[model samples]
Target: MSIPHGAASAAARPDRVDPAVRRIGATLVVGALGVVFDTTVVSVALDDLAKAFDAPLATVQWVSTGYLLAVFVTIPLAVWAQARFGGRRLWIAALGGFLLGSVLSALAWNATSLIVFRVVQGLAGGIMMPLMATLLMQAARGSHPGRVMAIITVPTALGPILGPVLGGLVLHLADWRWMFFVNIPFCVVGGWLALRNLPDDRPEPGGPRGRLDVVGLLLLCPGVAALVYGLSRVEGGAGTTGAAVLVPLLGGLALVGGFTARSLTRPGGALIDLRLFRHRAVASSAALLFLGGIALYGPMMLLPLYFQQVRGEDALGAGLALIPQGVGALLARALAGRYMDRVGPRRVAVTAFALVAVATVPFAFVTAGTGGAVLMAALFVRGIALGAAMIAPMGAAYVGLRHQEIPDAGVITRVAQQIGGSVGIALLAVVLQHAAAGAHGPSALAGAFDRAFWWSAVLTALAVPLCLLLPGRPEPPPPARTTRTGEAVDPRRPTV
Candidate 1:
C-alpha cells in the first residue's frame, strides 16, 4: 500500500527492519566507492598505458573506450539479471568479475591483451555501479529516499573529486599496473559487506520473467558502442574522418531505432521499459542529463590538458591544480541535496547551469601568464556548479517513478549519462585538437583552447531550458492499492 504523507511505508517500518537502515546505507556507500574509483583511475593512466605497451595513443585509448562500450552494452540487462538471479547473487558476481579483471589487467603483456582485459573489467564494473543504487533504494523501501540517495551518491560524487588525484599519486610513485591493483581492497570489502548486510528477497515471480531478449540486446549494445567508437575515432584521428564518423553513428541509430520498435510490440520482456519515457519529468530530465554531461565532461577532458599543454605542468601538477574544482564540487553536494528536497530540482538545475556558464567563461580567455590563484578560483566555482548540475538532473529523473520501477529508471539515467560523457569527451577532444592544430607555440595553443571553451559555455547555456520540465515540487506518493504485491495485477500495466 502507498505510504501516507510524511509517514513511513512497510519497507521502513521500525519493527520490520532486520537490524537498522543506516547499516545498510554503509554497505552501499562502500560498494559504490570501489566501482566509481575504478572507472576514473584508468582515465588518468592512459598515457602511461600507451608508453608501457609501446602502442599509439589511439590504440591505448581502447583500454578505456572498450570498457565504456562494455558498460553501455551490459546496462540494459541488469533488471533481467536481477529477475533471473537474486540481487545479492548478481551483486556479488559483479564485484567478483571486476576483481578478476583488475588482476588480469595488471599482468597483461600487450595493448591488445590489455584492451580485452579492460572490457571484462568494464562489464563487471558496469553492473556494480547501478546495483549500488538498486539494492540500497530497494532496501530503504520508499522511506527516506532522500537519505538513501545521499548515501549511495557520496562515492559517486567523490569519483570526480578524488579519482584524478589518486590516479596521479599512484602514477608518480609506482607503475601503471598499480592503478588496477588499487581496486582489489574495495572489491574484497564490498563483497563481504554485501553478503553480510543485504536482504534475501527473490524477484517477484510473476513479473517479466522468461526468455532473454537476445535480439533487443544485439541491436542496442552494438548500436550504442559503434556510435561512441565512431565519435572517439574522430577525436583521435579528424576532416572526412570526422564527417565519416557519422557512418557507424547512423548505423547505430538505425539499430537502436529497430530495437526500440521491436521492444514496444513484444510482451513485458522488452529489453528496456520504453513506457517510462511517458513521464514528462523522466524524459526532460534525461535530455538535460545528455546535455549537462556534454558540458561537464567536455571541460573535464580539457582542464587537465590545458594545465599540461598551456601551463607546462607535469601530470601530477596538473592533477594537483585541478583539486580546487573537486573540492568545490564535494562541498556543494550536501547543500544541493537539501535544496533539491525543499525547493525542487528545476530551479536548482537551472541556476546551476547558469553558474556553470559564468564560471567557465574565465577559461575562454586563459593565458600563459594567467594567475594560478585566479584560475583556481574559477575552477572552484565551476565545481560547485558541477555538483549541482550532476545531482539535480538525477534527482529530477526519478521524481515520479514508483519503487519497483526505480531499478529500471536507474539503468536508463546511468546509460544516458555515460553515453553522453563518451560523446562530450570525443567532441571536445576533436574541437581542442583542431583548434590547437591552427596554432604553434604556447600562446597559440592558449588561443585555440579559448575557442573550444567558448563552445562549452554555449552548450552549458543550452541546458537551461530543459530544466523547466522537471516536476515543480514533490507530489504526494501514489495510493495504497497500486503498491501492494502478490495480487492478480497485469504485468503489462503501469505501476503508478
Candidate 2:
C-alpha cells in the first residue's frame, strides 16, 4: 500500500555527462526538429493534400486534426513504455515508427488513407516529444538545468517559426510528398545516434512495471481524442447543429474523469502524475500555457485569412508576408532563454507577456487600407514577444521537478497548449463570424478581424498576472562525488 517514492536508484553513479550523452542530446534535437517539421509541413500542405485527393476541405482537414488527436491518445503511454523498455530503446523505436509512418503517409492516395497514416505518425510523435524531454532532464539530473533546457529547447523554439517557412518552400518547388521524405534521413541518423550514445537509465528495482493499464488507456485516449475532435468540429461549420461534436466531447470528459479517478486509486505514476497538479507552479504554468496557446496560434489562423480575403494576396504572397514574424521570433529565443536563467520564470514571463500585449495591440488597428509596412512591423514585434513568452513559462514549469518528472510536465504543457489552441480557434471563429455578419464589404471583414485581434490582445494581457505567479530563481545544481568504483554519485540523495 506504500507509494514507491524511490522510483530511480539513489546510489546510481551520476557524474559529468559523457560525450555520448552530448551526442545523444544533439541527435534528439535533430529528431525533434523532424517531428516539428512534419507538424508544420502538413499545415502548409493541407490545400495541396485536399486538391490532390479531390476531397472536400472539411474532410481533408481531419488529416491534421486526426494527427493531433492521435498525439493526445499516445502521450500518456510514454511513462509506462519508458519504465518497461528503457528510455533509449523507446526513443529509437519511436523515431523508427515515425519514419515508417511518414513513408506510408507520402505513399497514401486518398484523404482517408493519409489521415490514417498521419495518425500513425502522430502516435509515434507523441512518444518522442515528451520522452525527449524526459531523457534529457533525467540525464542532466545533477546538472544546471537552465543551460541544459536552453540547449534542448532551441529546436522547439525554432520549429514554429521555421515550420511554416520550410513547408512553404517545399510546396513551392517540390511536391507535398517531399516533406515526409525529408524526415527519413533525420530519423535514420537519430536512430543510429540513439543506439550509440543514449544513456541507459533503467527504472529502479520494484518500480511499477507490470501489466499494461488497458482500461485506463481506453478511457484516457478516447477521452482526449474525443475532446479534440469536438473542438476541431466547431471550426468546420458545425456550430451547434451540424455537430456530432457534443457526442465525443461529453464522452471524452466522462472517460477522462473516470480514468483519473481510477488512476488515483490504482498504482504508481498514473498515466500522468496527477500528483504534479498539487504543485502550484505546474498548475499555473498549465493555465498560462492555455492562454498563451490562444495568443500564439489564434492569430495565425486570422492573419492568413486577412491577407487572402481582404489584402487580395495569393497563398505564396501571404507566406512571404509572414516572414518578418519568423525572423523576429528567431532573434529573440537566445536572449529570452538567458534571461529566464538569470531572473527566473516570474520576471521573464511577466516582461514577455507585457511585450506580447503591447505588440498585439497594433492588430486591433488593422484596416483594409492599412499599409503593409505597418502590419509587418506589428507582426515582427508580436513574434519577438511570442518567442519570449513561449519559452519562459515552459522553463518555469520544470523549475523544481526532478529528472524523471520532466516527461510528465512535457505531456501536461503540450496537452494544455493544444487544447487551448482548439478553444481559441473556435472562439475566434465564432467571434469573427458574428463580427463580420453585420457588413458586406472588405472594410467589414477587416473590422471583424480587428475585433478578433482586440480579443486576442486581451487574452494575452490576462496571462501577465498569472506569469507573475511563477516561481522565482531556480535552485542550484546538485553536487557530484565519486565512489571507490569511480562512478559519479549525487550528494543530494541522503538529504532527499
lDDT of each: 0.77, 0.77
TM-scores of the candidates are 0.89, 0.89
The alpha-carbon lDDT assigned to residue 7 of candidate 1 equals 25
Stretches of candidate 2 above 4 Å error?
1-22, 202-210, 240-242, 265-269, 485-488, 492-496
State the lDDT at 8 in candidate 2: 33
TM-score of 1: 0.89
lDDT of 1 by residue, 1-496 (tens): 2211222334234223223456766776776676777777777888888889889988898898888778777788887787687678888889899889999988999999989999998898777777777766665554334445556667776685578878899999998888888889888898899888776655565754546788888998789877777776666665335556878778889998898788777767777777788888778877887887787678878888899899999878888888888888878777776677667788888899999999999999999889999999999999888888887877776765676677777777777877777778887787788888868888999998998899899888999888888877655433333336533222222443
Off by over 4 Å in 1: 1-22, 143-147, 204-208, 239-244, 476-496
Worst 10 residues of 2 by lDDT: 1-10
Best by lDDT: 2
**Collision count for each candidate, in order:** 1, 1
lDDT of 2 at 195: 70
> How well does candidate 2 score on lDDT at residue 441?
76
